[model samples]
Target chain A: MKLSLSSSPHQRVKRDTGQVMRMVIYAMIPGMIAQSLFFGWGMLIQSVIAVISALVFEGLILYLRNRPIERTLTDYSAVLTGLLIAISIPPTLPWWMTVTGVFFAIAVAKQVYGGLGFNIFNPAMIAYVVLLISFPAAMSLWLPPTTHAGITPSFFDSFSLIFTGFTTSGYDVTQLKTIADGVTMATPLDTLKTGLTQGVTYSESLTKPIFDGGFFEAAGAGWGIVSIAYLLGGLYLWKTRIISWHIPGGMLISVFVCASLLHLVNADYYASPLFHLFNGAVMVGAFFIATDPVSASTTPKGRIIFGAAIGFWIVIIRTFGGYPDAVAFAVIIMNMAVPLIDYYTRPRVYGKNADKGRGKY
Target chain B: MTDFRDLSLQGLWKNNPALVQLLGLCPLLAVTATFINGLGLGLATMLVLIGSNVTVSLVRNLVRNEIRIPVFVMIIAAFVTIIQLIMNAFTYELYLALGIFIPLIVTNCAIIGRAEAFASKNGPLASAYDGLMMGLGFTAVLVILGGMREILGAGTLLAGADRLFGPIAENWTVVLFSTENPFLLAVLPPGAFLGMGLLIAIKNIIDAKIAAQQTVTTEKAARVRVTAES
Candidate 1:
């Protein structure tokens, strides 16, 4: 028997799960580094814990189900989940919170939904939201930038703080923030929320130490650098064709347009487009979390709609809702609408007669 | 005798009122934020279930089939009212915490469902036992779910135990870990749903594993018998 070579159309692109997941992991590195730099090493340690736990859980579940564990483990989807969870959490969260989030992300979100492509909700976002609502205090504990603190946690301290809840200095991670002039340090967004509630004008609140050198109002110092890095990584993915431009592009545009409109109406109340763009997980969410293959819309048009809806909802919830951050909630809400969006936005095949028009058929 | 066991098993697992039957879910999901809370409600439910079941069974032979549904509902409502008043008097804090859910217990389909389906048809002893087992099963799940949520949400167990069990349980909360930041999501409604889902998934998985093991053993035994015959 002779083995024949096929032509271009017959020869497929040769993509595998491992390759796709690897690209995603690669795309996440710049953002991970930025998180480590700004938030301190807690995120990095959490990432490590999450990644290891996810892989172990994934493997265990696969073993229980009698699936090919090694092959599935190599795909790096578990790694992506870890990265997402790490970035979403407070850098100073305790070890068990990390473990619990990973456990839920893998066991409940992924495995119980039949694993990988079958999960209806974004596993990482669901875990993050669950942790956030369940542990509000831990979830909201953000330290000021290292520049303000005069103390940056060493990599080892970061590790210790996350696991043991105390740095080598005997100070708990929550106590390490700068307290100058009787003012406690807070994240720029948190500061803004509290300030606004206290009737502080947006521009006046911008003078707070947390926003000292930050590029835009309400953007945490050093956070914009991370956002920019994530944007760069997202652009690289788009350039390399690793991800389509529809979802990210649509999400950015919608957020920009919406924030602009809100700012135009009342600049005093609403944050600027730049503030919305460069702050709290907006860029990371636009490019990474919202683009999950399973939970996102399948069709090109649907992807755009899904992305825009998430952006729209984020703005609405952030501006008016109780939570300081709305990315996770927005993503989960949009996840539920993906199927409906895909159904309505499906492209018609060439030369195929149009289906019955509304009630006419 | 096996019939009794099967009935108990059916109420507890196979036809669980809260899970499979999806009856009494409102209260089950709402108040199950701690083990003691779940236990409190579950015990209250058991009282109502038993009282209603016995009353319905006694009147089952006297009432016409056409009006049996209304009669059963009234009996369940009456028992629920009695249970609510007693709880309000004894466990005021818990009663306040449970609030609408206690009265809403009147609408708990599990109580009415037993009255209509089992209690109205079965003998008094069986009916009462069924109600007791079903209520206990429901309470057991509630406590487990509540414990899971409380532990995850507040890093404590039996938080505010005094609310349900009174002063002995005051400060009975065992802190699993003390963090300035408690997980707020676990105590929230969404967490309740997630915890409940995990519980259901766990039950299903155990059932699946047992079924698979049974199938394997039966297959092996059948093959051995066939080879011996040959």
Candidate 2:
């Protein structure tokens, strides 16, 4: 084969920050579509509100900081962050809350910490945590997926509910939470947590209607499909080399291992591995959120350890902690550990002692 | 010895314990949830500062250098107890509201810092003035932070004023607005931190502006008659 003269990096992919960010946004479309289909149109509405507000806030902050607003905004990182936030929050969250969350994500969480790559914690997760803490009542008001709910809000209804806190047909999110069977429904993780707290066995809790008639037996209705879509999108990213497999791979394996070990010890108290994998934010979190390059572990080995730790915390917190979903909390906690992980897991240099190497390596 | 004017200026503006020196942050952050709570704690802290400063200055000559720290702490503890007892008697609700922080005033670094740095080398009158001015500075910050948090978190100012003042101040709460959900983050401990950071930033900005103005004037003054006017 004929060789062309080039230094070091012989193979190059024609991709910049804007391209990578666009790819990530493209990858998230599947998850967004699934979310909107399963939940009402509220997810789409919330996403639009979040993305617009995120761009506005990001631009404002950039302008105030005397940086190039157009170039940074074009990178689409803010859009992805806003989308991730919209996915994580309850679809029926009020519009103003979505705006406020986006503002905090862009301005305080991202810009205040020196913007984009310099942010220590993932801005989306920080905004999610802040919104979760600040508005617990509104944040928890999730509706049953359209499959179970008797009345699915139309696009107009979703828009109306977000803007005015009531649907066009005069139904509030709480009222819309009622399923066809006249029982108000929470998410599967929430249902399981509440059941476990009330001394109901895990197996008995699985028999709840939220879990009984789902498409997947292990994961509940709509959520399992949504998770599967995210997994497919994640697989695409993996195939395209947009993300490495270590972080997601380690996170999934560790989650399965932890849940299985606990489930094996006592089937009645603990949920199975599949439930842990396909429910909550595990699929999305492991693939998309935990793989955030800025706040995640940099070295390959460190990435694995970081992912595994987050996985363990997810299972632990979801099972024992007060919160039903653990992904946002888990990701934020792991982000704090990334620098330490990267520092200790630095790769050894060639022609140098691995143990003693400190300077460039 | 420093003049009263210089001492007052240093204590109040130049060398603020809460903002500049960053001393006694534990009480500054913890008890400043409302204006009344902050005011109550600030007053108690000021009393301890004054009492300890006066006492430490009086005994500065007798106490050996090796044992001065212990002596200063003991004096501060005594004053803290005195303030605690007084608050318990007159403002029992406020005392209960403050709880452990009243006794914790003894641990406030600003008190012992003044004792060791200022009172030990200064006359009683100067030390007393320093204490009063420093106390006022610390109290001003507490009041500002507390008021900011209260207005943001609860949409009211001087809420529960009766806790600090007598029952006659029951209606002192000025409601700025009412909402179903006030910003809960502002009431939390993290809010205290963010508010404190903002206050520090504001102070720095003001200082920078003053420095810039002074430089411009000095530059004008330093302009010599290099070229005699044509």
Candidate 3:
């Protein structure tokens, strides 16, 4: 054989699964810190629990399926799923519930669909929604941010509450939800939604004590700060080319256009565009969850359509539907439409005159 | 004798109506929230199937080819009406529980399917046997699916047994465990789909195991004959 001068590794491929996954995990760091700082140590503890369980389940399933275990674990998809599930849930969720969500995320959502890239739905969102639907009472138990509540539990107390559903001081999660004024502490979006449903105007809903500490009337105290943190992290992801801008751009534009129109029509009924953007999971979802490479649409045009539709659904569901925050439902719904969107949005080949939307001859 | 065994096997497993053919899925998913409800609907469906099958088989030679479908539908409809009236008069609670589904049995493609594909070409005895076996197969799935939904969703078995088996069976409800939050998903329609998907996955796993075993035998045949000689 003739001597070859080719160097090893042939060539380095950019954006491998592991690299992309690492980037995603890195992007979530600032957001996670913000969530824990504002919410408490509950999310951090839950994240630890979820990541551990997710890895365990992932390893177990791979072993059962008789595959290379190390290769799958190093991908960090499980870690990201754990991270997403951890942050998305209410802080006061019980330990076993977080474990249940992780189990469902890895075992059913990922493994049963042939694992990782083959999954049909976003595993974390599916697990979150399943937990939400299954345990509505526990899923809705959010402790107000430390800034608003003024009652800080030590790290150990947060751990005890999450693990045992009670603090060492004998106060349960429900007790933690009630502020000093005897009113239950709800998520800013939840409080606003409830107030509006009770026939309060948009501006009046903002006048409640929950919004008392905010510089603006759009988002609740501590929530807007968290959203801004996520937005900064999301922009970093975009700048690094880890995530494309088509989805986020489409989503924000649609939300802004839709919210402003509705607000212009009847400002009494609709929240302003700024409020909609900063509140709930709007920023995080537009940046992180909706941009999930596996479940999101791949084509350029399909991406825009997919993101716009999710934004549209978020507004409709939040304003009229039963739920207060709707990013999970909206993203899952758009995930279902990915195939049809991709089918219709297939790009035309050069010098080809075919007009079939299905990309078939 | 082989034909009889084949028919039985086809109905019970090989060609199960609910699991394989996926016929009459509405009642299969709807009424399968409880075991007794499944049994109630299953028995009613079996009665209609047997009656319609026998009648269709007996009159197969006389009906004209062009109007055969309409004639078969009419016969099934007649039996369904009789079954409905009998259910109304006797088991009123179950009748009410099963309600439109009992009347809706006339639309079950399994009954008409057997009438057209099997009974119309077979003798009355075979047709009746086919009906009995197929109906039992469907009932078995419904019963199993119902059992899953009930046990998982409500933490109880036969919770509504009295609807079918009378007041004496009311005490048969067994609480698996007491929990303030019953897995409402299992009793909900989504639970039915999830349970069904799991079942299908289980069947596929079994099939794969059997296939793997078959392949293992062939591999074993090629084993080197060491026998302390190598």
Candidate achieving the largest TM-score: 2
User: Model 1, range A260-349, lDDT digits (tens) per residue?
Assistant: 999999888888888888888889898889988888998999999999998898888888888888999999999998888988999998
* RMSD, every candidate, angstroms: 3.7, 3.3, 4.6
Quantify how close model 3 is to the true structure by its C-alpha RMSD in Å.
4.6
Candidate 2 stretches greater than 4 Å from native: A1-6, A354-361, B225-230
What clash pairs does model 2 have?
none
DockQ value for model 2: 0.76
Restricting to chain A, the TM-score for each candidate equals 0.93, 0.95, 0.93
lDDT of 2 at B208: 98
Q: All candidates' lDDT scores?
A: 0.85, 0.90, 0.87
| Clash totals, every prediction | 12, 0, 0
Range of the 10 consecutive residues with the lowest summed lDDT in candidate 2 chain B: B221-230
**Which 10 residues in a row give candidate 2 chain A its minimum summed lDDT?**
A352-361
Residue by residue across A23-57, what tens digits does model 2's lDDT show?
98888889889999989888888888899999999
The deviation in Å at residue B207 for candidate 2 is: 1.9
What DockQ would candidate 3 receive versus the native complex? 0.50
